[model samples]
Target: MTKITHFWAFFTFVAFSLGLSNCRTVKNGLDEKIYNG
Candidate 1:
């Protein structure tokens, strides 16, 4: 049970990171100066 919990946490983190990356790219594209000025 503990191992399963750890695995789920890791999976969730990875998914969250991926989602964030996608959003960041879209945001930068919309306002490149704000993010990469």
Candidate 2:
């Protein structure tokens, strides 16, 4: 049970970090588009 809980916590952390990175890239893309246009 402890192992499963640890795994779940790790998975959630990884997913949250990935989501943050994705948002950063998306925001950068939008900034570039605005500048170019």
Worst 10 residues of 2 by lDDT: 1-10
Candidate 1 local lDDT, 1-37, one digit each (tens): 9999999999999999999999999987889777676
Q: Write the per-residue lDDT of candidate 2 for residues 1-37, one digit (tens) a residue.
A: 9999999999999999999999999999999999999
Model 2 score (lDDT):
1.00
lDDT of the candidates, in the order given: 0.94, 1.00
TM-score of each: 0.69, 0.97
Report the C-alpha displacement of residue 21, candidate 1, in angstroms.
0.5
